[model samples]
Target: MKFLSFSILLMILHFTTYSQTIDTAGYIRGEMHSSDDSLVGYFKFDHTFGQNGQSVWYKKDLQTTKTKRFQTYKYDYFTSDSLYMELFEVMPYGFGEIRVMVPRVINGPIQLFYFPHSTPFAIIQPKNEPYLIKTANWKKRVSYRKFKRDMREVLGESSLVYKQIEQETLKYDDIPMIVRLANMNADESTIQDYIAHKKSAATSTN
Candidate 1:
């Protein structure tokens, strides 16, 4: 009788611990998108725990999967606004490149990402550029001279945004507006072309 009672207590403890550790109630629906914006699959979204948790996905067929690093999760609830969370490679001051899941603030020729997890709270990736540019690192700091030079280099002379950077009219705080302007730049339409290329590649793969 004691052994049976102990076994029941163990089961109760197991369930109690699980309920506290995992937050299955906070599930949301979303679709998994590949790095190139291709749809990988659809699943219900959740974190292993409550608040700022790592992403988890569950399929309708009962299959489960963890978030794919460097991919994106498009939330279904934000249909009109279409919000996206993407995993990006971030290089913070005094550290090597690390991958963190962050939100894409502005999706354009020059994409702006918000990195709330660490220093250099913001980064930008220009169309076709392979590296992320840190907007400002509060620790190491960004000089105006270097900022202008780097923005010019990143935007390229042909881009209309480059003029603003060259003329010193835009500041670090104007990154979102600059990104919007970059999207408007006719020369930067290569981003659209790139998207088309990705779609073609995805179609071919399928």
Candidate 2:
């Protein structure tokens, strides 16, 4: 009877850790994303977790992962806006490079966007086909300078949105202004207020 009671106690403790608060400041409606659907795969979105020049955002803090130092980052989920899951380098401080994993179907082919580079450089294996790995969709890696040139050519020097993209990015600190303002209709002041509130709340918490 004692052994059975102990097992039940352990199970309760195990499941309780999976439920975590998802609201975080400076993160614009913090989102909880999970790749595995298990208790251990849920990742928390923390916008204020990195140092300058790194442009880091989400950590793999699934309550189980992040124990391994080298393999700590494995956030394989996307946002409702389809703009949150992107992999970016903030040191250059622009949208020059972006990567994301999009799910088209449950248990289907995971679409990976590898930024200014290839179209799905890595094939995320399905459960049934764990051995399948292909590079058929790989494209030439575009240099950062080349990608910037392409952006300028497409948007042109007089483009308001493109110019705003650059300006907004420079003005903001850690969060990517381009991605945050992608489909948002909020004005500049409103957005700034939101960000400021978030930062203030975060500072209070710590």
Candidate 3:
């Protein structure tokens, strides 16, 4: 009877250890994406004890040299009882990059979020309520206005390009040089224009 009890205890301990090992609060969880949205490498995060945690991930072709590196981040929850996770990328030079924390939230579950190819913005209020906030960063808001205008133009152009590409593909039934070029150009232009617009808007708003 004693031997049987001891065996059960061992089994329980093993299960407990396994459970602890599998529990991770916030993590990258999968693979890193390349510039063109291709899966290049894998990353993993293991959190043990306390609110503070660390993560290690592999990024491929990080620099112009096409070299890969194992990037690490220092992470913490926004609040002690909060589910939101905050991560700061540790860089060798200057201040680290701050990004919003994404959590897996549940065990044995896959959570996927889309990152749109655009910039984000925050609102700023003037100290004086009646003050007319015409400029941001003491610069004319013309750049910001131009950016929004450019984005709309690019989106319209890309839509037309895509439609032409689809029609040509149907007619040719094969990859043609012109069609490929148009499609690629449209995609690149769209992303570039969107980013430019976002930057301008953010600057103006600030």
Candidate 4:
């Protein structure tokens, strides 16, 4: 009887330690909608232990759309957790299926993901290394004002179209300059940095 009690106590202690660790994963949740009224689906954060890939639960609203054909689906490809996810879907046109379009930059062994749909982009630079600057050196030119005018001149896009041309991204330095110029909302510290950079860029152009 004493042996049995000791074994049970040991088992409980073992599970209590590991179970708490398993339950402390991090994630973010968001809703999808075509308009103010038509809520199409939602993207839920999910995680797994000892797994190769990540998954997200996509849910559709049956009551608002007057349809019962679909319930929820799980996509199994993403592989990041506990990191700040900037945005998951496109802005302004935020609705419908949660398109998990993750564009990665791999240099040797390190990989970095940036630019979420609605979240502010995070830029992290390594200590010292070669950076692949892919876009035109617009920041080095006259000013942000002149750069916008030139974008309209060449691309005929005067509006902030940062999302459309993100695929052309190529370097770390270009990120903050572009992001600050676009005036996107971000964390307080990041916003302060953007403002400083913007002011510096304006001063440099003058």
Best candidate, TM-score-wise? Answer: 1
What is the C-alpha local distance difference test score of candidate 2? Answer: 0.32
List where candidate 3 sits over 4 angstroms from the true fold: 1-29, 34-37, 46-54, 58-69, 72-97, 104-206
Q: In model 4, what are the clashing residue pairs, if there are any?
A: 87-116, 87-117
Per model, how many backbone clashes are there?
0, 0, 0, 2
lDDT of 2 by residue, 1-206 (tens): 33235335534532332122122332222343456531222333432223221122343353333432211134434443323332233122144433222221111122222221122223652122101111234222223334444334433566443465355432222212322332244466644555565456568899
lDDT of 4 by residue, 6-69 (tens): 3355445434422322233422233332223223343344323111222444445323433222
Error of 1 at 23 (Å): 14
The lDDT ranking, best first, is: 1, 2, 4, 3
lDDT of 1 by residue, 24-43 (tens): 36333445454344333443
Instruction: Give the worst 10-residue stretch by lDDT in candidate 1.
Output: 71-80
Tally clashes: model 3.
0
How well does each candidate superpose onto the true structure, as a TM-score? Answer: 0.43, 0.23, 0.18, 0.23
The candidate scoring highest on lDDT is 1
Give model 2's clash tally: 0
**Which sections of candidate 2 miss by over 4 Å?**
1-40, 48-77, 80-83, 92-151, 156-206
Worst 10 residues of 4 by lDDT: 125-134
